[model samples]
Target: MKRTEKKRKDIIDAAIDEFREQGFLGARTTSIAQKANVSSRTLYNHFESKEALFEAISEIMLEQNRSMQPVAYDPSRDFVEQLKDALWGYISIITEETAIGLNRMVLSELIRDLDRSRKFFTETETHDYPMTQLIGEAMDAGVIRKADPVFATNQLLALAKNFFFWPEFFLGENPTPEGVMDDCIAMFMAHYKTGS
Candidate 1:
């Protein structure tokens, strides 16, 4: 990577740690610059302000996870297996150490800034999420009962997050409990699988 790019990455990494430790309001750019081993001027050259840096971190977090290839729906595959694969992929991404810390920081900030939270959610909302697309295709292929794809997608995610994400997010639990994913899939299939 170019020097500029490496420095920028270092700034972001340091900012993540700072924000995670001190929060958006409490974090200071000077601290972040010092942690990154860059001058304050360099930090500002890369990111104009602390808010800008925070926004950049948020964007990078979303982009890093969204860059994963979308799971394609295969008609010949078992619906449960396909759903399991897609759901696990998502769970893995969100449960990563960095992702969890970033999410905690972002959520805390968003709670105090209603307008920013709205903008963040609006910007991030999309129909192309892997599970959503997989469920839509499954519906079209008669593998699942016809329903609102987004709602079904939420149901699946809610189930998985309750076990895999919320506990970890709130209580710092790591390594999802055994059988949680399978149970989530089975419950979702019970509700949505075609001919169930």
Candidate 2:
């Protein structure tokens, strides 16, 4: 990578660590500069402000996990196997510490700055995530039946997260024990497959 690109990456990493540890409100440009081993001026040279840095954070997370989606149901794979693969993939990526920390930081920002949070939520979640598209496809294909795809998408994500993942973040340990991924996938599949 070019020298400028490397410095940009360095600043981004530093910002992520500070934002995760201190949140948007509490995170300091000085601390981020220290972590990046750059002057504060250099940090600003890459990103004009903390909000811009947070926008970079949002962009990075979305890019990395963009492909994390429900497996398009294939005739070849059995329903259970495909469901397990799709749901587990989504949950595992989104439930990681980095992802969770991002969410918490954004949520905190939401409380302080409703307009920014709402705008961020709409742009990022609506365009970047395929949550609605995934569930809608599942419904159209008869994998799941007679449901509001938007509501289903939200609830299913919340179920996997709130029931299985959030506490883990708060406690500083993921609760996904042995086979929990499989079990969680199966449990949600059970909901999706309930006979119409």
Candidate 3:
């Protein structure tokens, strides 16, 4: 990588550590600069503001977990099986240490800045995620009853969040219970899947 690019990456990496250790509101750019071995001015040269830095950090987080992006829905495939694969992939990504730290930073930001939190949520959850598109396709193929794709998406995601994400985030609870993922898929399909 170019020298400038390396410095820029160092700044973002340091900022993520600072943000996770101290919430975004509590973190200081000077601390990040020191940790990155760059001057505060150099940090500003790369990112104009803390919000911009946070955005960069989010992009890095997404790039690191790009494998979690769901595959395209295949109408010929079993809907429940496809949904399970997609949902489980997402759960695996979010449960990673870096992803959980990012979630904590975002949730902490939410308490202080609703607009920023909303932007983060929209960027991460609504726009890029493939689950909604799959749900919509399932609806079109009559594998699932017609409904608001977003609502169905939320329902499926909420179930996984309740079972695996939120509890682990909030309580440091273990999410390794056997059959939990399968149970969530079964429950969701029972309610949403359509019959002949």
Clashes of each: 0, 0, 0
lDDT of 2 by residue, 12-100 (tens): 88888898788788999999999999999999999999989988887776676666543455655565565555566676787787787
RMSD of candidate 2 to the true fold?
3.2
Model 1 alpha-carbon drift over 4 Å, by segment: 174-176
The model with the greatest TM-score is 1
Clashing pairs in 3: none
- Which candidate number maximizes lDDT? 1
Residue 179 error, candidate 2, Å: 7.2
lDDT of 2 at 155: 65
- TM-score each candidate: 0.92, 0.77, 0.84
Candidate with more favorable, higher lDDT: 1 or 3:
1
- Clash total of candidate 3: 0
Per-residue lDDT tens digits for candidate 1, residues 6-120, read: 9999999999999889988899999999999999999999999999988998898778667867777898888888989888888888888888988998889999899989988
The 10-residue segment of model 3 with minimum total lDDT is 62-71
Identify the runs in model 3 with alpha carbons over 4 angstroms from their true place.
Answer: 59-68, 122-128
Worst 10 residues of 1 by lDDT: 122-131
